[model samples]
Target: MKPAGQTHTLAVVGASTLLGKEILEVLKERAFPVARIFTAGGAETAPDLPVLDLGDSYQDDVLVEEPEDSEPDYVFLADRLRPAPEGTNLGLLHSAERLAEAEHSKVIDLGGFMLPKAGGAVRIPSLEREGRAPERLDSPATSYYVAPHPAVVVIARLLLGLSERFAVESAVGEVFGSASEIGPRAIAELQKQTLNLLSFQKIPQAVFGAQMAFNLLPRLGRGRTQPGEPAPLERRIRDELRDYMGGHVPLPALRFVQAPVFHSLAVSLYVRTREPAPLAALGEALAAPGVRLRRISEGPPSPVEVTGSSDILVDALTADPAHPEGFWIWAVADNLRLAAVNAVEIAESLKSGGP
Candidate 1:
């Protein structure tokens, strides 16, 4: 299926971090048929891609994807990987399960350090397709494709499209996070602590060990919560919203702060409902189909107006005046342009599932 306007041959592998240059500017703002891009890393000098050839061990570019003179049908793991690494992919992604033995290699982990693996399968092709249960890059399954965490793809596709008409009985949120999501060294220490506290100077927290400028750090450098493990970014966003909302939706109650602004992402949802749904039926279930909802006279969608939007720009739409079924959902997502458009839309659904 990798045919729409061009052909394919991609690879970005930690390409000199900063979300590997925002996954090459979201794969050239989603034109991704990737006719040849290959920018490998590690000691990284590798960045001249016009059909490759910076070769000569691009500073040991981690075995340049099994080099048969440039091989990368799809590889985008944009930097920051370290959960377990021993025998190389030097610029990381052997992050675990040896990336399921790279069968014809298809690893799209936009580096959530091996995307929520409490036993795999957390895909979200805008919420699965083909007879169900997300498995079709020609069925066999698991050639590695992580990408699901842009706040669990904006809370699992806005609570699985509002649980197909108000079935979600609970959800409480507050994920703010922004300093360009810690990359250019926590955005150069949040612009050097907002210019050393607006020129008074001295606030140089060794890259967010604290004082994340203007601070909302509920736990940006957390130093507590040790008994009964769950508070490390709300237990990894409730185990990635139940591994991509599979239990048919339920667990929410989240709260991952640390925002001083640099890129997008400002969710605040509070939904609750099992029956009687209102407030224009939860604003038409948060404007369902691949979502876009931003009215209420357009006032509350920030993160600098969802920077380079790939939509999730919802605004403060309130409703629980006394819980007639309760509601409220404000959002803003561009977190690395929705994790580089969900890793080039899951490598264009595995290159359009074509054999």
Candidate 2:
């Protein structure tokens, strides 16, 4: 928890995109102790509000004329910058090279890439970076360390204290990523494809390989490289979980599929635990702090129900009597919101003490 009475100043660069906009919404919804908020964008298409013009250089802090507004204290950069600007404390919402040359107050990078030796920013990778030893922050560590995927964070939190009870077996995730996930280029392509029907019959294959409309892609990330190759995001999660749980827990076999829906990520876990954990007991465990267990007596949970929701919904749970050890569970959450919140939590934790 944040220290009492201490409000934090925040700035959100690229506030126009899906992830960036979602971050702002989460901040507002959670009632985060924000003293001031600054929004910046590259193009004028974003909301008509006060913003800071970077103009390709980090030196100048020229404020755009606004109706009567105040200055911001901290800034969250959702835009892509090779090296962050100088002077101000930054939250690296996108990946970039080392900006050690700049004297930033603190930097929280959303990209999972390894940081330079100088140390200043905190790298919060996806659920994949969980078990690995985090880079040390020599200077004032950034305010947040976060992942952009909410389902990952919620699942991680759920498993945090319950690692001893069950063992995750084969796991599958269905992602309904927002338009922002592919950025403006993909959205523009999608819109263009939607507008012209007769001659412009082009398949949307830029951000996602296949046409995403009314389709499902079983493979995501760089696809299967080779037999011995790493299992992209899913593999990373399993390895990291194993590490975080101190190897006492079994790593899950994961399969991720991309769905056509927008905004949320839903996951189904098929676990083989040592003992049979009743549905009531499992529900009680999921109801623990930070989770919103949905009580569903019927069909499977969908992305539409989880979109925009900050809480991770655990809907269905059942036992596989054949393999008495088998347990099935369902989970859903807003990827952007959950990821940003988890990153912020990490940032706060590092700010107070080393993680």
Candidate 3:
């Protein structure tokens, strides 16, 4: 191990995407110790850099790994997470896999490249107190650490808190997604579609493959799978939830819908408990780290309200009218901010040896 106070070099692949921008902002906000920062993206799409260009720097292996020395302390894969059309935007995934195989730097995956069985540890620092965040973050065998989907973090933390205070029987979540979850392309498409519709012109459907403006979709029109098959986003949430929850609580039944919004995520969840859950006691239990509880008098939390917020906002917590043992909660979180904060926290944990 190197000296404790020695700052290290870092690289962020796909550093031009929305998530990449968020990660860089968070790193600067949190004042992460970095000797140098390098960015990489698609050759044609990447912005021009002064000297540390990806073409010369990344390919030289100096940014990825040193011959007999350790240089880059971390490599973050912050690519567009929403599954793109097959054979599109896969260069970052290739870089992540190569870095993981090299085991030179601690690779943190903000992208969904590392799956449940990929041997990468799924980390949520907010759950560290609950013994849910992985303990051995710097394990040699596990070079990749997955910063889970923001929805997974929000749902898992809420369910974990409830399970700690009551016997949770089952839970159902309706998660509303926004264009920012895909990338800048989806956001541009949505904006263009909205303008075209208002002006009575042809709308673009390349990114979303549907009329994303003033519309709600159960699945994207392009690259759609067979009936009953969960979309890519839903499948990612389900797989990561299971991996992180570790069977400690009932896995929530999830449904993802694409909403005509630009950022953040809104979730409507109904949970059934083994015993009658008192509203006051339930609120006390749901009060966990990285979660903010809003009063009913404050109305419900909205995606706009939670933008740029690191905490998941929980509101409209009420008991089910017919079933005393059931409750409903509406949650909103800045999808990029939440995931970015968690990824930074993971790096913090590694530095401090906290988890």
lDDT of 3 at 124: 88
In model 3, what are the clashing residue pairs, if there are any?
A: none
lDDT-sorted candidate list, best first: 3, 1, 2
User: Per-residue alpha-carbon lDDT of model 1 for 196-267, expressed as tens digits?
Assistant: 799998887776788887877776564557765555656766776676565777878787888877667788
Model 2 — TM-score against the truth?
Answer: 0.66
- Models 1 onward score TM values of 0.35, 0.66, 0.84
Off by over 4 Å in 2: 1-14, 31-79, 83-104, 113-148, 164-180, 184-200, 220-232, 235-248, 347-355
Candidate 1 TM-score, true structure as reference: 0.35
User: Which candidate should be chosen as best, given lDDT against the real structure?
Assistant: 3
Model 1, residue 297: distance off in Å is 37
Worst lDDT run of 10 residues, candidate 1, spans 50-59
Cα lDDT listed for each candidate: 0.65, 0.50, 0.76
lDDT for each residue of candidate 2 in 1-355, tens digit (9 for 90 to 100) = 3426777666565555555565666565555676555554423133321121111122122222211132343445455443433443332322233333334424443433322333333233322334333233254644333232444455555554345344444333333444434455544544444444435676656666566655576654345556666445555444434434344444455665666554467777766655666767656755554466666665556666766556677776777678776777777776666666665655455445444
Highest TM-score, which number?
3
State the displacement of the C-alpha of residue 186, model 2, in Å, after optimal TM-score superposition. 4.2
